[model samples]
Target: MTALADQTRWLDATAQAALVRSGEVKASELVEAAIERIERLDPGLGAVTLRYFDQARSAAADGSNGPLAGVPFLVKDLLTDVRGQACTDANVALKAQARPADADSPLVARFRAAGLVLAGRTASSEFGTTPTAESAAWGATRNPWNTALSSGGSSGGSAAAVAAGMVPAAHGTDAAGSIRIPASCCGLVGLKPSRSGARTAVESVMDLIVPSVLTRSVRDTALFLDIARGDEGPAPADGYLAEPGKDPGRLRIGLLDTRIDGSPVHPDCAQAARSAARLLESLGHHVDPGFPAALGDSTLDQLFAAFWSAGMGDLLADVARRLGRDVTASDVEPLNWALGTLAADLSADDRQAASEGVAGFARSVVSWWDDRDLLLTPTQAEPPLPSGTLASDPAEPMAPLLRSTQFAPFTPFVNFTGQPAISLPLHTDTAGLPIGVQLVAAPGREDLLLRVAAQLEAAAPWGERRPGL
Candidate 1:
């Protein structure tokens, strides 16, 4: 790679855009640098699954118009539909299928409209069913910080690429903590925008999955949101990027260090949370140990599990039918098989109860947020696990796999509530693994979250620290 590429590779998207816009560097030069990094690093990381170098190069040469004029980005393999891109969702059953999409998905279109270059698609778990990025088709995605440890999933591939400087930012989706978990593990800023911020068409059969970006800096994420949340009509009262740096002004920040389901948080993870609380207090924000009253009910866990299982079952069945094959336990991961079985047993009344319960829980949580500006917690209950720890052999029983993966208790609740949350790289353990602190806000209050996150970033800068890479 050229010296220009080397310097620009680690720069945040906003900085890179500024460089390009000022003609200090060309977009093609940046794209070439990104492609070089992907070629050199992705062999060992296995983060990138598909390449669009030719397309990206052509678009960069064409000189697209927008704010992010030459920034290279990757899409998570799960939700995006890039033209001529083969999306496997990292499942072996669908490996043979590669088709052209007629047009960019709304989110992709927005990225293109912003002049961001789409480099390729990143790896993900089968149908994004698992939290770890161990795919039956692709090998495990190793953390850039330490290859032996995991890069959390199903957005693991995107997180790894961004952390390794292969791309400035990449897209990720959170169905059940997919985005935040990986971002925390890889030491990137990950925000799961509210379901309303999602650009894809909603499917009635499944629970809502919010799509978002993972970036090295808060401003890049804010910029991407500004572009992605296009003029679908009039902007929200708190417009995108309207006041990202505006002072939140002595906010009441609730700190929840304990797990919601009565499980214990790992020591290192707890310390990270405490450190974040202290930082907030030092910044003149009121930080107190508090719990969300709505999450105190154990029944919510049962409902969340049922809804997630049901949604997975529906997606798997649809994929199987589309491929002209009979869906069977042997064809999928063990946890998915167990989920399918549970889904089959769920009656309409059971599903209705789950939906109503989750909705009520969301209302309660949002009501509490009206009193507090943000809720701070650990992004995961523990640090990143050793690679393959969350992996399940198709031959094994599924119950153990599910229990083993629940070490991450802090991320799924926001998905369940459809609230906006961010995972910030605030602390690192003695072993040098990054531990993320989560900042959650009320629904549609992403602007507030971003401003506070920028303040926190200034308070504790993480940009200079790079994973071993």
Candidate 2:
């Protein structure tokens, strides 16, 4: 590889695209470089489950001349699809028998229209049931900072790939912090747009899932939201946002340095939020130790699981139908299989109650924004755990999901509430693992999130911090 290509691996998507637009680097060269990195690094990382190098090269040769044209992008092997690619979604059954998508999901189409080369599919949790990306199908996506640790999933593979400099940015779906958890672990920017954000039905937990990317910079994420948001998005026509610092003006920001259940967060994670709050206060924003009361409602967890399990069960049933057989313990991950059985047992009344409960909870969560401009919290309850920390046990299928409550409790509620939230790499654990401080804005207020996120990024630049291989 040329020295420039080596350097390009570390460049953010915006910079890489700029090089292509300036004629300093051919799109094909960028694709080839990424392919080489994937080949060299993915063997140990397991970040990529499939490679479509030839297709990416072809697109780079003659694809849309959109703003991000020529940047290599990987799609998570979940709901979103790249036509002709087998989106396994990190399931053994799907990996073995799923057919290729015939057409792109709207988000994928937007990605292509903006000139992003579809490089491959990244690993995800089986059906995106768990936060960690370890599965029997694709193994684990090792964190670039510490290979012995998980990269965080169901978007863990995409996060690992980007953090490893294998790709500038990669598509990831956030139903319950899949994008932000991995972004926090990998030291990238993970944004989950409003529920109406991208208009995709992937992992639709009451239509809670939203599509976004894990990028190295807040501006890249901002640019992506502009390009990929649905027409219904509050500002679908928003242009590239600039960080004027003072433009966003003083705002009311609350700091909740605890898990939503009123449980204490990890020392490092709590400190990260506190530190971010202090920084925001320094930047002329009002920061207080308060969060939405709705967030403290532990009953919402049951409500979410009631629907989440049903959705998982239905997905597994569909997979079985496609494969012409039942998906048993051997076929599905224990955690998801247990959840599937829970779904199978849910009755009409059960679903209706869950629906009502979620609606009420969302109203309460959203009401917090009526008075507060934003809520800042620790993205995860703790830092990245070691490999197999969240792996499911066949004898106890629900163990992993239950354990996730301690590992990742703060993100899922945002999905249920349909608010826009971003996880920024603001602090690192004593061991040097990245700690993410989350910022959430009201529905359709992604523009505000971006502006404030850019201010934080400028005040505490994290883009230059790279993990040692």
Candidate 3:
């Protein structure tokens, strides 16, 4: 790669697109630079699971002329689809029976329409059930900060790629901190927009998943939302680009440094949250150590588990119906099989109770916003765990998953509440791994999250930091 090409590593998608638009660089050059980065760095990172360098080059040479035209991008190998590419969702059976998407998914189409060149697909946890991307089908995605540790999953590969400078940004989805967790682990900015942020039925199908992006800069994320948000409904008036750092008048920000269920928060994670609260207060926002009453409900864990298992069961049942056979234990990973089996054991009444529980949880959490504009908490209960720490133990399959829930106790409630949340790489542990502090806003209030995230980014800039690898 040329010296100029190497320089692309430091630029955001917005700047890369500017180069293309200004005729200073060809889109093909940009694509080739990213392809080179992936080829050189991904062996150790294990981020990109599928490559489409030739197609990406072709698209860059003659793709749509939109805001992000010529910028290389990656899609997670999960919910989002790229035309004619196999999306395995990190499942071995799906990988074996891979089928190319007939067309781009709505989100992918928006990505293309906004001029993003779909370069490749990144690794994901099986069906996005786990928070760490160490699927048996693709092996583990190692953290760029420290290879011995995990790249937080289901969106781990995308986060790793972005962190390692393979690409400026990549697409990700968050059901329960899938995007934010990996972003936290990999030292990037991950934003899980409100359920209504992107008007697509794909998310409504599961009613939990929300498509988003992980980027190095807050502005890049804002630019993505500007380009990708739905055109139909009530959308942000002026869009998110440059909206960051704009004066977001003093606001009520509630601070909750501890896990709602009273699980022990790692010292580093607690310190990150405290640091973020102090930063917010210095920025003139009112901060208080308070949280929602609903978080204290012990049934919250059961409610999320039942819904998650049922969702997995729904997925497997659909797969079976399409394949004309049942998905047996041998067909999936131990954890997935266990979850599916548990889902099978749930009665209709059980599902109904779970649904009601989720509804009540959402109502209770929403009331917290009635008094506070934003909520601050640790992104994860702890920093990145070792790569194999959450691997499915054949001797005790469910234990790994339960441990994952505890690791990310603060993130899932936002999924149920359908609110906007962001994980910012605002602190580093003694070992130097990034620690993320989460900030959440009520539904349809992503603008607030972006504004505050920009303020934090300016107060403590992290864009220059890169992994040693």
- Which scores greater on lDDT, model 1 or model 3? 3
The list of candidate 3 runs beyond 4 A from truth reads 197-205, 233-237
Candidate 2 C-alpha lDDT tens digits along 1-469: 5675588889999899889999998999889999988988889889998888888888988856887989999999997767887878788888888688899988898889889999899988888878888989988889999999999988999999999999999989998899999999999999998876322222337387788899999778877887785453444234533432336789999888977656788899999999999999999999998888877876666777888887887788778887788878788888887888889889988888887787777887788888989999999988898989888798888988888878988898888888889999999988878999899999888778888988888899997788987
Candidate 3 local lDDT, 1-469, one digit each (tens): 5676589987989899999999998988889999999999999989999999989989988966888899999999996668898888887777888878899999899888888998899988888988988898899999999999999988999999999999999999999899999999999999998886322222122888888999999999888887677574333336777579588899998888877756569999999999998888998999998889988887677766788888888988876764568888877888888888888888898888887778777887888898889999999998899999988887898887889987998888888888889999999988789999899998888888998899889999998787887
Q: Pick the candidate with the highest TM-score.
A: 3
Computed on alpha carbons, the lDDT of every model, listed in order, comes to 0.82, 0.85, 0.86
List the candidates' TM-scores in order: 0.94, 0.95, 0.96
- CA displacement after TM-score superposition, residue 403 of candidate 2 (Å): 0.7
The ten-residue window of minimal lDDT in model 3 covers 196-205
Ranking by TM-score: 3, 2, 1
The digit string of per-residue lDDT tens for model 1 on 423-467 reads: 999999997889999999887788788888888899999999898
Off by over 4 Å in 1: 197-205, 233-238, 261-263
What is the full ranking by lDDT, best candidate first? 3, 2, 1
Q: For model 1, what is the error of residue 68's alpha carbon versus the real structure, in angstroms, after optimal superposition?
A: 0.8
